[model samples]
Target: MVALTGTMGEIPPGGTSREFGTAYFDGAEWWAVIRGKPIMARWLDPIQPLQGGKIVVDFTTDGKGLSSALVIGGYTDQPRPSTGIAQEVIPAGLATTIVFIGSDGVTYTTDRFIGSYSPGDPIYLTWDAATPTIIGKIQSQATPPPAPPPPPPPAVVTGTETLLVTASDTWGVGGWGRWAKSQNGGEYVYSGFWAGQTLTGSWFYGAPRPALQGKTITAIKFWIPAREPVGSNNAAATIHICAHTSSARPGGDVARVVGPFDVVVDPGFQGGYVNLPLTFGPTLAAGGGISIAGDPYIGFLSRLKDPQVGKLIMDWSA
Candidate 1:
């Protein structure tokens, strides 16, 4: 039996079509077998088999996972099957074609898909050629599951928190960004401490800070005393606020917690406890540190105390 792709079209002028695969017969002699049975041989072309034309086959689908009808090429000269029912079954989860041979030797098929067919079991196929339309049986009868429950409300901020976390001034995510002096007074972290920048900067870089565990950070405050702008050059800084989980040095990518604002110092730079707003910031886990960084020639204050009071602030909830 030849395998057919089940699609067809007409041959163009001065040309032949090969859609028939190997199905053909010259002068009314179709010579092909399907499902181990000889099919009617009809004249498709005037010349040899599969020469001037091709056989056409097409199909249509029905419900979920099922096919309804199939259009088969004609093969004349053989008596039409009187049984009116034919089945071609495949493996499980495969569709079995139920063929109905019409009185004119034309074969049409409607398929009943096996959803979970068992192996070694015979598939039933009973169809009438006169009425090839058969509504497939309901393959599955299992009831659907219930919908899921809704999520709980979000946690609200109840109070405030303030802590002096170590600050650092680093050019990038590279080594501690020039951590020197003391880890306690190393609250100043500068983002401008590259090879060319001078060490006269006023930032601190040291070990990570205490974790604000379960506390939602609101802002980080820093101190910048009044200084001479003549040596400032109207310079600005991009402060990178972070919350790290490491005890060593904090990296930007792994611990950044929001507020990375830009600040420019003009002539009358009011030096006070400047807050890097962390509104709607993330919660700090255990062992988390806070730090900042900026561009070249900019210094950030860190680790504030009662006198200086430059520190990290947050909103705490139960």
Candidate 2:
């Protein structure tokens, strides 16, 4: 048995492979008596090595018993260690040692040795007793996804509407001379003779009701009758429908003359009335009055004794 005292010598920084101690056993014929029996022995003092020291023990049948070799201050094939610093400070006395292990299984020692470290400071180290290295720092963070694209703009909406306006003479009684009736009471006439005088006439203006407010007038239609029986006195004349601001007859003008439509007396009289349609660009507002006027020779058919003078048809949109 060996009794060890004092330091066996400081483990070198790199390492040294050398035999430290040895043991022996007698293998002659006298030892055969105890070969099959169990033998146990104990050491009075335990072996302790400084940091980085590696001790290896071997047994050989060639006569050597327990032999030990020391690899002083060496690295092992182990994974490198990484940690955040707890504190970092210059050493007041002996400098501390730290080590680092590379991914290629090579150990590296750091040059700097501090007494302390700090939290959040990144540390890369190895199992070797080399100086610990500070690589960087770490911080916690969170990032949100990009905001969704803005919603598409709302779509525009548009449509169309129509207004049909018919003239009425119900506002008064005796001014019905503008309207005429056949002597036989067959059908009413407009701008025709009644009781021997030729009637030149104007009809009451037609305007949009409250329901048709804010609409636009797009077209106008005139329904006038051809001279009866295709007579020779039937002449061509100009017809007009004017727009005004007031409902009263011949009020302030909004659109002075909407039309001066020419009409020819139908020589055949195949149909009693003809429809004259006039279209306008864009449109006109529904805020005003519409009145009908014409040359004396042009006449419109009227309803019998109904007090309605003329029909003014309007096509509109809103």
Candidate 3:
């Protein structure tokens, strides 16, 4: 560890060590302080993003340095009701250093919460600017391909090619699932993949994007297949599906369900077929065409989890 003395705190060696609340390096050496008192030094780890813009962060600390539990609180637009903003009180003075993590990566060293006078209550560290040690040997990895270019246009304009969707491993774990298009087809597209059990019965997707202000679609239909080995969570197989329209851009989407059709049945795992009734509205067209799509993609939430599999068969004849 390259030791140094600075205004932050006492520094220590760097790496992927969980030395939270323990000695850490802040350009120079300076001990970590808890509640204005010097305690074991610990460094805060950066946070990572989850689906839907959520995040998670963590840090470890040696329990011996602080007097009381480590306080964790922050300010948010959704302020806490009366009493006080909810704070996490981690037991302090542990044999192993304690760690603190957050959903966002904003640096905060001040008390970001509002509470009555309580000496031990946790608040942001205003006295000392939070010192985050530079550590971890992270390698920059390549980003996955963009949501497979929207599903390609249908072979011909038989009826209305209203809906098209595709999904997969790249679009997070819960690949698209439970898609429905109207019997009066116009045009549509969606794409994605599944990796686990997911309930996407309510997810909506489409093509005649929001840009298509107002238009009317005639009808739409999908011939999605499900097999015995592929209907539920503990199924014997997995599946992928995509859909789209005749617009300049294609449409794509995907989704899955775990089933043998059991209590824990898969949505598209059985060999037969399913008819997801679809409803449409005036905004079918994005101020241009007449088409709409809903539940374009839905399914498993995590790649580690099991996902449903099957083919999507669409028809405009209805």
Best by TM-score: 1
Candidate 1 stretches greater than 4 Å from native: 1-157, 166-188, 193-259, 267-270, 275-280, 283-287, 301-309
For 217-286, candidate 3 gives per-residue lDDT tens digits of 4443333323222123354332332222223322332223212121122544433444432232232233
lDDT of 2 at 308: 31
RMSD of each: 21.5, 31.4, 26.0
Q: Which candidate is the best by lDDT?
A: 1
* lDDT of all predictions: 0.40, 0.37, 0.27
The digit string of per-residue lDDT tens for model 1 on 293-315 reads 44444443333422342344555
The C-alpha local distance difference test score for the whole of candidate 3 amounts to 0.27
As a whole number from 0 to 100, the lDDT of residue 6 in candidate 3 is: 28
- Write one digit per residue (lDDT tens) for candidate 2, span 42-81: 2223433233232233211222233233222223355344
Better of 1 and 3 by lDDT: 1
The lowest-lDDT stretch of 10 consecutive residues in candidate 2 is 29-38
Model 2, position 164, has a per-residue lDDT of 29
Better of 2 and 3 by lDDT: 2
Model 1 RMSD in Å is 21.5
